[model samples]
Target: MKIEAHEVERRVETFKAAVQEAGLKLTHQRLEVFRELASSADHPDAHGIYDSVKHRLPTVSLDTVYRTLRTLSDLGLINMLGTAGESIRFDANTRKHHHFVCVNCGLVRDFENEELSALQVQEDLVGFGRVLETQIEVRGICNDCRNKS
Candidate 1:
């Protein structure tokens, strides 16, 4: 998905509004972190985010990036993909969509399908209570990895 400039601006604005609604302090670091996430198509971890933000704000620390990401995740502004065993990843596309995780390089990419979105949960599966969310992660080698092999 090609994220346009206006779309990034819109997401950033929405993020700002959410921060205000959550009564969280709005800092330049937070905005920069959000912008970096908003503009990224690759699901990035805290370290990746820290690397990106540090290019613009050299004084920014990894801890600041983590805290900003935590605050945004807590506010429901972003989706935290904890299932990534190697490293926790974050998705800016909060919409209902699945993921394609490349097993070779651990790359995460978004995937969307009407049928997947329309799936109905059985609710009685293992007595896990009501299912509030559903996300499918298809693990396999990506085109790049396949070509390399």
Candidate 2:
């Protein structure tokens, strides 16, 4: 799921604005890191992003990539997925949407459903807690993986 060039540019602009607004310097490495994540839909992790960014920036360390990702996530410029015990994946799309996760291949795809979006958390689920957002993750085998088996 390749993002359009125009959308990528728009996201880059948003990223720059957000960085400046947060009083952070928009460095080359940070831009490259964001670009890599923005342009990708595969939901890459820190190591995956590091591998791609290292080609253009040979001096880039894995630690830098980790920190850059953390900063972007902290700034609400990106979304993080997966549980704490598992490897974390990053998604560039921050809009309201649900995910279809392939249990076999670990592929994650975004989808939008009005019904799902309108769902409300029941009081029984979170007694005194408030629900800020509701997102559903439907897990199943993807077509390719199902066919391969």
Total clashing pairs for each candidate? 0, 0
Query: Could you say which candidate leads in TM-score?
Result: 1
Local distance difference test scores for all models: 0.85, 0.88
Model 2 stretches with alpha carbons more than 4 Å out:
123-125
Give the alpha carbon lDDT tens digit for every residue of 1-149 in model 2.
67789978988998899889999999999999999988887888999999999999999999899988988898888889975456888878777889998988788888889999999877455576766789999989999998999
Model 1, which residues run further than 4 Å from truth?
none
- The residue-by-residue lDDT of candidate 1 on 38-110, one tens digit each, is 8988888999989888989999899889988987898898988876356778888877899998889887888
| C-alpha-based local distance difference test score of model 2 | 0.88
Instruction: Give per-residue lDDT, candidate 1, residue 6.
Output: 90
The TM-score of predicted model 2 comes to 0.89
Each candidate structure's TM-score, on Cα atoms with residue i matched to residue i, is 0.89, 0.89
